[model samples]
Target: MPDNATRVLILGHGAMGRAFETLLSARHDVAVWDRDLVTGVETQPLEAAARGREVVMFALPSNPHDELAARLAPCLATNALCVSIAKGLDARGRTPAQVFAQHFGPRRDWAFLYGPMLARELQAGRPGFAMAASLRPSAGARLQALFAGTALHLDCLDDVHGAAWAAILKNVYVPLIGAADGLALGDNLRGFLVAEATRELAGIVEAMGGRADTAYTLAGLGDLVTTATSASSHHRRLGADLATGDATQLAASGANIRSEGVHTVAMVRAHALFAWERFALFALVCDFLDDPARLQAGLDAYLARRFAAPTGR
Candidate 1:
């Protein structure tokens, strides 16, 4: 390690964790620990690994964030920054920021990294982009230092809540693109959905106490395009499966498929997070998930409503 290397601990050794390790290990002293250990790698206990670390990254899904945050809170260094890349909501409909704030409070330094960061591309040493938002003003600079000399690039922003919601909401919209492609609706519809999704996303983010423009940032529009079109994206594949009437795959347990959007749909609806009537596109997605048989008609009706003329004129 370089003389100026920072100590970093990455929680969760999944693909994203390993990708981050690959990105940062060359310049930083890095340690990784997962709940389940791989066969041939040496690892340390979570608490031990966290001590003295300047940055601790949670690369796991949002569902496990609560437990992990609670466990690692006491072990983290006083000024250490906690970064979460989770792009979904927890069972309680809380974003990663909500979970972190619950455990770390305002005093602790924490940040959210969100964007079009595909693990496969990052692992392959291809360039990736993300936005870093944190309560601490310097958190972005700290993250930039941590990943210096790597292909991953970071843009700093102050709208942490907006960025987080943008990231989460993008995943929810990706399925619509996949479903359109799966139905052979062509590129015209795909383009339309992308435009409408971005608009609706801005409104929803604003309503959720985030800046509307943040929806156009890397965390929202950038990530949405990547996840929507990527062949390897789980949510995209879920939409395709839904289009093909693959009930077996659609009904598979979350453990088997790991589609965050599916769980997001449930959480949003259950919590009544937004005014559903205002977001017709999102509401249509929720309706599709509830009854896949209505997809074709739903799309037709949605398009009709969009193209409908001014009433009574």
Candidate 2:
């Protein structure tokens, strides 16, 4: 327990961690750690780092998140509030809140942040926004205050599972969007892709016990645009690079912080169109990345599925 400092321990310093540090370091004490480093930051062991922190944000990629979080569980101070900035599918098959509760026990607090805010832009104080939920939703206020009227629009959301599910599902269509662009598709095609994907996800989440509003909020539309269309997105880049037959480069892009969606494509739990969304995306991504010869047909068929009458929509 250090004196005269509000310790903020940030795990996963890639984009979001640095965004927090770059923005909040001037007013708060911060330390960062990541399992693998794309760029270096002064970091401490998770247990050691958690020893006396007032706040701990888990900004990890979704892969192996459960294992890593379990390892981090005992290290946190009993009162430290945990926040997660992860917005991809869980390779570990656990919810972000579940991971936190397992680690810190019921006495501690936790939160999840999902939105369109890209780590790179957020770090530089660019315009950004996010939806958040916490056991102590007010705990989000501290962070919201830190971002205040800045480009980062911070709002409180009460639905945890729905928000998380929407966040994970949005990753599915971003690659499809990339596939669309790779094959010389227009905005009309991209828009059609997003609309169809949203309807499918909205229905699935509602059936799975989530709210329809989940699909229209910051986590859904916001994240889809950034990830699906942004040139800087690793997932979007993966699709385009693979389309160009640059498997080596595409593979290299994910080496540091691998996109969890790419890996989780094999295990998506939701159904999309006539088949499982996960399965359809997995096949398309594999072809776009592994066998470019089939990119055109895959992209076209996937798009057609979306805009094709919509089953009487």
Model 2 alpha-carbon miss at residue 192, Å = 1.3
Per-residue lDDT over 1-313 for candidate 1, one digit per residue giving the tens place of the 0 to 100 score: 7999988889888899999999999889988877753363436667777889889999988988998899889888789899999988888889998899899988888999999888999999899999998877788999988887898999998899899999988878887789889989899989999999999999999999999999999999999999888889888878878887885656775722257887887888889988866799998998888887798999999989999988894
Q: What is the C-alpha RMSD of each candidate to the true structure, in Å?
A: 2.3, 4.5
TM-score for model 2?
Answer: 0.80
- Per-residue lDDT of 155-188 in model 2, one digit per residue for the tens? 8877766777778767755665776677677889
Q: Model 1: runs farther than 4 Å from truth?
A: 37-44, 253-257
Best by lDDT: 1
Q: Clashing residue pairs, candidate 2?
A: 127-151, 128-151, 128-152, 128-153, 272-277
Whole-model lDDT per candidate: 0.87, 0.68
